[model samples]
Target: MLQAIRDTHRYSPGELRTALRFLAPLGLLIGIFVLLPVLGTLAGSLYLDTTFLERRFAWFDNYCGLLTDHTFLQSAWFTLTFAAVSVPLELALGLALALLMNSQVRPLGLLRACVLIPWAIPGAISARTWELIYNYNYGLANALLGGLGIVGEPVNWLGTGAGAFAALVLTDVWRTTPFVAIILLTGLQAIPVELYQQAQVDQAGALGRLRRITLPLLRPIIIVALLFRTIDAVRVFDIIYILTRGGPGGSTTSLSLYAYRNFLGGDFGYGSAASALLFVVALGLSLVYIKMARKLKIKMR
Candidate 1:
């Protein structure tokens, strides 16, 4: 690969132009569907736009409001904590489940399909299902806790601030863990069997081989999964909206939900500012993760 770089003269400007031509349509689509909308929202954030009111440019006043908004701060904290907690849990559980599925466990073979069932159900439907599971009375969660003698009485899973937050986290983990598993499983399968065999011949144990070989080779894929999951987790809405409605003292409201409420309440400027901030946060995290991955790769060399 280093030699190939040194021989870069083999590549021509014609090839570069051909590649650009091929990519032009994709760039155009991104500009139309993504860039243009984002630019529009950023512009909208500068206004005092509201329903039945004269549209006026406020120029960062909306953003300034976010600094003093208690609910906004709480929602932002909830959003960050939710992603911080959920993504790692998903990744860990997913790695385990993926390893199990990829093992010689024939009983787990059916799980390849079963794992996707929760994810396949529409988000709205799944959220409703979880709502029932976390219901204050006669719900599966309460029933199980009662049956196991874990709690003396039914817990208000979705009616209390902390309980509601926990419920959201658990529901999200259950719903999205399968997706992480699938991504890891694909990466797991790509690893050469001979590497493991070689490790075994060297008298390496399962744990040793996994840490030394599997994880190191799978770093790039893991980063990809983390990137995708982190972005999705931050933008989470449908499930939270359906389950808790950002209720129980507004302890579980995510930034996306906050923005949505703003939009629904006809405060387009505030909503746009919230959304633009979310975009910045997500983009910043993505860049950080990518840079960390690159740094790790370099360190490995």
Candidate 2:
């Protein structure tokens, strides 16, 4: 009994130490970064006014007002439209780029590296660069159009609602497509060469092989890539904010930017409500993605 007791005591401390070592850093991260901020935000959102220099509870008034706010509605719609348009286009373009890169093209390694450069750059920096290019008077975009005789005057690219929206889409696409390409490239590279070899032996054309073999095997990866891009696009703020500030008459405002402005503009509770709503949307997308992933897994099996 003493020997068994000693053995138990020996293992108990070791196990406890091991568990503590694993959990300590995680606990610190959660407490300091995640938990604290979330609690602060929630607490702030419940207050009557953050700017009051005094504390008072507001209950659900902020949330109730947010539901009726026209600006929030417009921002939500604009953000949704941006995601709906951009995510599908990015997926298609990225997959196409991945396939092209995967082909027996010359200097494929260099090509892949070149393609990733845009995605590797900081998004705000990319936005700023595009903003310069988009400048009406002295921009390269106008110069190119002029060179091509496409227009008689320098297009005020960011001066109109449609123009600003288009610019945001273009900049985002340019910056993020490379990431999509990289993700799809991983999927493409995972495809067995033997499958293609056998398909060729069976006299399958490129399109037939891709349709029958490549896509079936790539569905999961494609879904994953789409999910990642869609999530990012849904919460997109920096590019649009920097380029348009939801301007040209709030034409390009997104939910994230809207929430940020509310919070910064001293409507903390309302902003928090908007943020919570956005969280719901993001969470819904995540659930859908997970369901799709599971369905793909079942189909694969």
Candidate 3:
């Protein structure tokens, strides 16, 4: 690889230089916005004080403290549970929607565009909208339930512990399911038409085709979408903050919200530690998914 790269560069030095020139700006931007912040966070996590006025190195103390911190543990647990539940739901609904969109239907272009509306809307806006919908008095949720005679009184959707968690999950699902659907739809479109035709000639029904061909082929794309959604769910903050503010006894507080609270409270070191831990958790999850995807790909091959 090294000799090949050297030969290519020797034969086309100008092309190599031009490519480097074009990439320089992107590399600089990533360094400034991504790499530097990550390094700074890692460094800050090792110290007891982030401010230059009172710098004190306390290696791993903040991480150790997190193990015993009830708020941190609770937030971590809730965040994990949230991702675990919401990711699968999003994948299932998204796949179903993708199947629907992939079908031969009237107004296909308009339907595809309409499906993306929820995903195109900002999460903060969606959260606010859902908050209003879930409001106890004069809220759509309560009104609809009452009219259907499901509940005699207005249920405080965001006030109670279970209600707040469910509300957040529902909000997240509505906002992100479209994104998952779009990804799966792309994957679905990439599937070869010839394969389906052959399956039809072989007397394979829809379920058999899906089981043997479609799913196996779509596995990689599904894993990619799942990884994206899982990471997003783990780092979720804006929607939860907007809707519940981790209210009702901190039942819905996510790791990101917990980190933000610590940061705002001037515990920079602790906040950075929490942020670093969140990064690690997200990275760990991504790595696991990548490993599983690679193994699956190998088996498929």
Candidate 4:
């Protein structure tokens, strides 16, 4: 009882007031910027607010249509598939890059900054650049492939379902891998060097040290990176819009894009429904990711 009392922290009334004051601005901002918009969208989803038509209450009809809409289903599947594939690849590549950065590489500052360039580039600009690279005639990708004898002809990257999928995956991985690497690198730097030194003294080889020391320590950060990347992938929109515009029979249409299309077509009620559903999915996945991470952390500890 004595130890528990010492371990507990109790805030005084002054501290409670100060803390509340400090948090008030953040609470207000969230209310205005996040909660209000979300609530508005949810309320709007229940009504038919189309142009040149009387506003009518929808009452979940839009959601029922989404359940049976072939386009919506296809887009949802594609979005899930994109996230499933891209998130894992990003994790793997990010892990490799983080390991490299963690090593004693020269010019570390410059190299770290260079690694961030891809991520810093605007999505629309990068997408446009990639569009050119995927061009059928004289594009850089095909030129290299042909020069290296990898293929006889230029591949139509955004012209087919499979090709477009692969293109988007590669683009997303390239663009976002650096973000994961940076996060993982922070975790790597936090690990005590003494741990590695001790492992080495115990006759642990490089692989043994990495497996026993590095990976276990880095697991939490990896899961966090996974959560972020998966969420970004699930809501991927601007890149798809700029790169392929959900081309090749809408094979790459993400749920976001699907909803955007409805909004563009003036189906406000339906679009709001789609947006609400996507928000729910992202929220659910984030909760699951956090819970799983917590469970793993507890198990490991």
TM-score, each model? 0.93, 0.87, 0.91, 0.93
lDDT: worst 10-residue window of model 4: 1-10
The alpha-carbon deviation from the true structure for residue 188 of candidate 4, after best TM-score superposition, in angstroms, is: 0.5
Collision pairs in model 2: none
* Global lDDT scores for all candidate models: 0.89, 0.84, 0.90, 0.89
- For 231-262, candidate 2 gives per-residue lDDT tens digits of 89889999987888889888788999999987
Estimate candidate 1's alpha-carbon lDDT, on a 0 to 1 scale: 0.89
Model 2, residue 112: distance off in Å is: 1.6
**How accurate locally is residue 277 in candidate 1, as Cα lDDT from 0 to 100?**
93
**Deviating ranges (above 4 Å) for candidate 4:** 1-10
Instruction: Tell how far residue 130 is off in model 4, in angstroms.
Output: 0.8
Estimate, for each residue in 97-180, the C-alpha lDDT of model 4 and write its tens digit.
999999999888988998999999998888888888888896889988989999997787678899999999999998999999
- Candidate 3 to native Cα RMSD, angstroms: 4.2
lDDT of 3 by residue, 1-301 (tens): 1121132234378888998999999999999999999999999999897444487899999999988999999999999999998999999999988988999987889988888999999888988889889888879989999999999988888888888888888889998999999999988998889999999999999999999988888898899999999999999999989998998899889999999998888889999999999999999999999998878766754
- Candidates 3 and 4 compared: the better one by TM-score is 4
Whole-model lDDT, model 4: 0.89
